[model samples]
Target: MEIMHAVDFRTQLTSIMETLAKTAVVEIGKLFEENSSFLKLEITRCTRENESLQQKCRLLESELQAARKTAGKINRTEASLSHGSTGCICVDICTPTRLDTGNCKLYITNTLHACFPDTAHRPAIDNVFGKDWCLNLWRHEESNAAPNEDTNLSSSGVTVEPVNLLEEEPDMIMIKEEAFEKCSSDKTEEDQNKRLRGAIQKQVKEILPELDLKKLQNVVNHLVYVVGVEKIDDLTFVEVTDLKDFLEPIQCRKLVKTLKQKDFFQESNEQDETPTEITLTPLSSIESIPEQPFFPYCPANSEWLQRFQIPWDRMPPALTQATATGQRARPGARREFVRIVVAAMQAICPNPNLAACREVARWIVSTYPLTFGDITEEGEQLGNGYSCLQRQLKTRVEHVNRDIMEHRIRRPRKGLATKRGADEESYVGKKFRNCKADSYGCVNWQPSSIPEGETPNSLEMKRKVAAEIFQSAGPRAVELTNVDDLMQQTYVYQRHMINSCPPPSISEIELSWPFLFTERGLCRHFKTLTGIDIKSRFGETLNAKAKRILNYFNSQRLRWNEEIQSLLSEIDSDSDGTDNNKTAISAILLMMKYFKEKETSIFISADATSTKMSIEKEMTLPATPRLIMLGNSLLTSSKWFISIEGRVSHSIDSQLDFAAALAVFFGCFYVFNIEYEESAIATLELIQRFFVRINTEGTKCTSKSGTSRKTGSAVQRKSQNFHPRVATFMQRLSEFEWKTSN
Candidate 1:
């Protein structure tokens, strides 16, 4: 029994072993297959990477060859120039006669100018190159007959007609000579200051020979404005830190050393002129210095007072009645009175300083002691009694000044120069003198009146019909000229509806006017309201500035956020090619950070895995318009969406790129006639000024017909005017461009 049991156990063990062997073999086969698949994938990935590297190498090789050819050409041109060939280098290389384009023209022009900087040699150049040679070179045209047909070359090989490039002006040489003659003829304090500034500039240039003349001028201007230092005697007040923004550490050190030497020379000269002995007068015999008024007081019978009286008489009966109530007026009534007073004040002084505003406020208080006075109920003085009025008057004047500085409207002095004797006129200055400002500032934003031909009921009927058409036939159907006409005719009513208090939700607005949400519809509506071709303006500006925009991008060396850094990397990778979309987006981002604004205000990126959550979170915030990037990353974004009024109303294809997306996104603000996101106002304003070139006084504007409505108080306007940052950005860019050109 034991033997038989043992034999059975052996058989059972053999069977079990066979089963285990079969399982092991199957597992080994599966492992081999998995390893083979992984190896295949790895090999495929390596091959792709190798191909990509090879392509990059090929591109680099081609670029190197082109660079070599350019270097060779430049060398030949330089050789010819050094040898005094006297050939029309500009005509040969820059004229339309040549198939090549780019810095060749700039190079020859610069070389010629460098060789002949004096006016004496300018005639020689003219003799050699012809009377219209400079003009031809600048215009890049074969003939000077078509002087108006000037062109600027861009990196993408596209040509753009610059606005002021072709405008006929006095010859620069003549202008300089006239200026020099004027300075020489006048020995006034102003002329002396000019000479002093010129001397300082010359010294600075000597100290920093590598720096551009423009950059040195900027540095001098910085000193003049910031430190109130223009005279050689003022050199003691300047510190190296004052120039930190404009120069490198080493440059700043060198500049400081030079300034110290200048100061030493100035001291030595003063010492040589100082008298050895001094005399003192008795205190009782000395006459007291007159105490100057803290605020200059204009006489009641002065020109400004007379000017104010005329506008004061033109006040509407209702406003006059309201102010005569003698009690503190309501906000609206007070605003009207303040407007009249401020308008009258500005009429006399188009750009009033704080002291001027104080005088106007004092006059107003003296005239209307009961209604506009800043007094306590107990009749105690309220610190000058005109403080409140002064604040208002100062604020109003500041708003207008801010607008001018921001380039929203042309300078009153600039526009006023055109009108004779009216230089003293009391009219609202040209509010939209700049083409871009005019286009953007004319939007029927905050329209208070309906169209002349349309009544409220008619507008409502048109809206209903348009909504029905949009719902049934869709956005394409509404794009028809007929539908567009209806939309245009009711734009005023639409503005009223969108701006209604306790505003409608995004879904409600979309449902009621779906066409307004379409891309074409948005642009058409914006154009109808603002008279601005948003797409064309944005595109033309972007394309014209494509090379500069890329230069601006590559110049950013500041430590940035991860996202911005990633964008900068992409831009660097695509350095050989120009990508307007990428450059524009990066520029906007960099500018936002430069201005110390939150990036999420104008742009939001969502991970593809959690787009819903990311966007949902965004919606919960305020209804600020935003550009949404919906994908795992910005570069690989699957879609772009414009999120306005807490909803993604428009989706743009990824391939359309961010420029188009931004254009549409920007249009949405005007089409809806909505305010920019509060936090992102600075960033949006930067884009408006830098990209769209629309520097309107205010976004919440009035109708186009009447005198342009004034912007808000100084505080409000200051918040809205991001021109300080924009100006700094532009100044830096200008300096960079000057460097590149030189």
Candidate 2:
């Protein structure tokens, strides 16, 4: 039983081993088959890749060969055109093998149409040979045949005239010579020339009526383009007279007789009263006559006078003075003198009227022989003497009045209380009042009262009243008064008071009263009230100090008003109709607070980042979308990871710390917005200006440097780099990149 059990176990173990072996074989075979499949796939991919690479290489080689052939053809075409060889017009030329094809034929047709407009043989040639062969044949035909009458003319069915074709040719030397001789001697030529000359003369005559003599003379004197002076003499008498008429009157008269004497006209000698023929004479004859004198006649005065010879008394004073002084008369003075003289003469004429005083003065200066020496001394003496005479006349009038008053004293009226003249109601009721006062004590006196009568006592009283009035009125009353009032009152104290007030603020003060608060008052107040002499400290004058203060106040007021108005306008314009005044004010306050805090933070951060080149470099990144992502990441990471700490030992120290932080924040904000925007624009402008300057300077330097060794290498390098192909390739690449990006 034990042996049978052991045998069964062995058999089962063998079966198990066999099953394991089979499974291993199946797995190995499957693995092998998968590897084979993968190998085959890879081999096929490699083969296809190699074939594609070979095809690309072949294409590149073919392209290179084509390029070489094109280059050769271009060179050959250029050479042919330059040498003026009649091969193929460059427009028709193509690859040598393609020369026999329809494309080439089409090219030739187009080229022929471009080059020769009247080549009639083009169609026939096109019909006989292909367009390409036609081009070749056309080249041969152009080389062999010169354009002539016999050549194929038009293609549009219109026959070109042989004479017209002949006339188009430039070789007309023989014909020109023959025509010149014929024009010189033939009667027909002479007639034609005469007709032409007559036409020119007639035209000149028509236009000459519109021209001034000077302009006509200029036109006549101008050398003729066709005929020389010798030919001008050959013109007939009538033509010569026409030419003369075109000349200046004087020149015409001079030439007329000479032309007549040249046998160009028949002179008649009959003393008939009525002349049948008009004879034109030489200009010299008329020019030889002496000029006639011009005379001006005055009917009222019954006087006939030569030109520029007016009556001596009709001259102006200044002109007379200038003449006497042997000095050239000024034009203005002469004109004035003439006017004055004419007026004086008219006044003295039969229609006599008193001459104006100014006119009389003008006449005197004009007529008088006042030399420079007399003008220097006698003129001033005369003026002074006249003034004295006037004063004497005035004094005489006053003396006459006194004498009449004294000699014919008012008769004592019946029942008069006192001397009638002294207590007269006529004098008492008179409006004329003297404000003067003497030393005598007046009982009926007041500071505001005006004195009457022209006595020493009255004068003294007036002065005393003025003094009292000023004393009674305090500085404030005087200060508020106008300058005109002070002047009229003759109050010196009042003027002083006004002057002592501070100068008015420019914006706050009325336009009418600018000097209410004068500079002097400000200075005085500074010393009296503040005990600080601003003038001394600032080294400023009273006026300057006042101006400075006014300016400051005006500027402050202007700013305040503008700010207020802007706020008001903003509130009023609000569509919501909310009380935006408070909101605007709050917004402004918030902005200020934010700016202050930001400034402090920015200042601190800037100081911290001073040595941090990485931060600066990062900040310098272009503001593109790509950089925006990175910037956002940096910002978030910085906010999340970075912390700032502040410590202060005292209140003042804390305040300083806060101030510094505020300054830093403001700086950062400013740099991020305003400064960065300005910096970018400035940098771009600087670069552009730099490039412009460089280009301009380089061009100038090259021009000035001339063709020298210093510039040769650089120029050659530039030329090579600027090759058309290279430029085109770069341009295409740029376009491709741009398109791809877009």
Candidate 3:
């Protein structure tokens, strides 16, 4: 029974599966048929709609065409009307009719008769306007006849005249009316002035917000005075009337008085009993009071008053005796005393020379015992020999003081002496190493190893020891292999230390190497070593070279003597020359030739000869002429003459010489060299002189004879020759000539 039940269940499941598959197929077919029918109905509806839209489109297009035609007709009618109104149209017709009739013909015919009343009795309308005009007139008349059809005409039954419609109103008359109305409504001068003042006050309040009304009024009044009434009126947005009324009499008087006080004006004195004519005194004629005297005196009767006035009462007996008779043992004793007092006074007051003499003389006469015999025992002995001298001194002082006060003599100014050789003295001897050693030791003083219980061998040993110790802890210790390496590494390390150390001194490192010592060299080295360049090192380079060159120049006694001799010879030749002017000209010509051969682009210029002047007189060329020539030459050649002289003067500085030499070389190359390949060589050579290290102590070979001659043996022995290609190139350039256009 279980097996039969299983078979029946399997059969029922298979039948159900078959039935579902069949139903699915039928449903799919029915759906396809319904979709197809629906699509057909939609297509039919779309086609009908399209046809209706087409009909509507055609109707709209037809209406647009009719409107365009109507607009074109209207435009033509308007053009014809414009032409007819201009009286340039004519039309011919058998009978006169309002419909499309030429109105221009009638106007022309009427106007022709009006213009010439005495001519032929009547003129044909066509004579005024021909057939073309008549056609235009007809079109205009037609347009005018159909009043409703005219697009430009008004809705009223009457036709709008084109002339009336196109006519523009006169703008000038309208503008005049507007201006008149504005003028009538404008404020009066008085009101405008009031408003201007109010505006000024308001602006002042805004600017100086803290100021009071009274202060603002005062400022405004000042401004008004500074800027005259005419100027104020022009600047301000206000009207002016009776400007004089705005100013007070007192203020006007003050202004006039101030103007009269100026140096250019003549001032009248109102205080004079008789009215004096105002006059101006010449500035040159105005006299000043003289500050010295011609006569002097000492009062004899004022001894008691003089004694009371003196600050010191119980002076030495000698001084008292000298004071008693107003006598002094020394010659010019009073003058010396006056000078000392004057000097002290000058320290207090710059202009006290006159005061010193008067004050001292007055004090001396009034405070001292005056009588020659009025003296104590000690004073008597001193007075006996000095009485007359003292009297003379006092008299002279008195006279000088009086003359100074009375303007009888002029004061002489003291002369000032030049302080040329002023210098500070060092406590140490002159030989005490000019090296600047501050907290840091001298760069020359390197430390060296010394035995524990022994003194260093010398300063050099001590320096070595210090250097070794410094290197051990320095940044380049690993790179320092040998003494040479140590020296090079030490230099870099010391330089860095000097740079990093606070308040570096001048003698932190001894820059003795010629090329390495220079600023350019150091810059090059720094760039090569550290890949960084700096500009401040240029002065260091120049300074290092300057010191070496200066030392060399100063030390060579023979060279100095030779230079002196050469200079003396040149001076003597200049002094003895008969035609100095010709000689100077010759020198200039020679210089020009030399520079030209060298391919230098500099030119020599002299003034055109006007009159035959003496050689001596002509030799002294005017500085202005030379300067003008220099400027012209520079402009023409596009190169400057660095060293310029009048055949007599030498360069003031070494840099000038170097610059002049370099310019000459550069100018030459630019003028001659079509291919500037050798230019770089010359430039490099010149630049090297500024930075290259030269071994000055290197062996120099010279021939025994005064002139050096190349011998066969010498040529054979020559191992190396370093003649720069630039030198050879420049030599060849001497033959080249510059071509100019005709």
What is the Cα-based TM-score of model 1?
A: 0.38
* Arranged by TM-score, best first: 1, 3, 2
Off by over 4 Å in 2: 1-277, 283-287, 297-309, 312-332, 352-742
lDDT of each residue in 1-742, candidate 1, tens digit only: 9999999999999999999999899989966654453355357546645644565566667768977986786565445444554443233232343333345445545765765565433322222222354545545554542543344232335443322211233243223355567556544544445555566666676666534444466677556544557456566557778886665444565566556654545544564443212122222222222222222245433445443452567665665775565444444556667777677766676765555665666656555555565433233223344655566676766776774754334345544565755654545464443222222334345554578878888999999999888878975785488897888888887777676666667787788788877777787777766556777777777655655755665666564466566656775665434555655665666666556666776777876654544676655544767888766555455467787767677866445666678888987766665656555665676566566655443343322322111332223333221234444455456546756766
Our tally of clashes for model 2 stands at 49
**Count of backbone collisions within predicted model 3:** 31
Better of 2 and 3 by lDDT: 3
Q: All candidates' TM-scores?
A: 0.38, 0.12, 0.13
- Ranking according to lDDT, highest score first: 1, 3, 2
Answer with 1 or 2, whichever has the higher lDDT.
1
User: lDDT score, residue 712, model 1?
Assistant: 24
Better of 1 and 3 by lDDT: 1
Tens-place lDDT per residue, model 3, 165-205, is 11232222123345556556443433444445454445434
Tell me the tens digit of each residue's lDDT in model 2 across 1-742. 9999999999999999999999999989966654453355357546645644565566667768977986786565445334433433334222222234465546656765664444532222223343354456446544544454243333334332221211232133113455467546555543544444333333343433323333333333222321222233333243334543234332343243334343322221132222223222222211111212322222332332112233565566776666644543443564454454444344343222112222223223333323211121101112111121122222333343454555334345565666676768568766753322210111111122222334445444544453454456532333444432432343222222223335222222212222222232323332322223433433322223223222332333444444444544554454544322223222322222212222121111222222234433444422210111111212111111011112110111122222222122212111111111221222212111111110100110011111222333222212110112212322233334434445
- Measured with C-alpha atoms, the lDDT of residue 224 in candidate 1 is 58
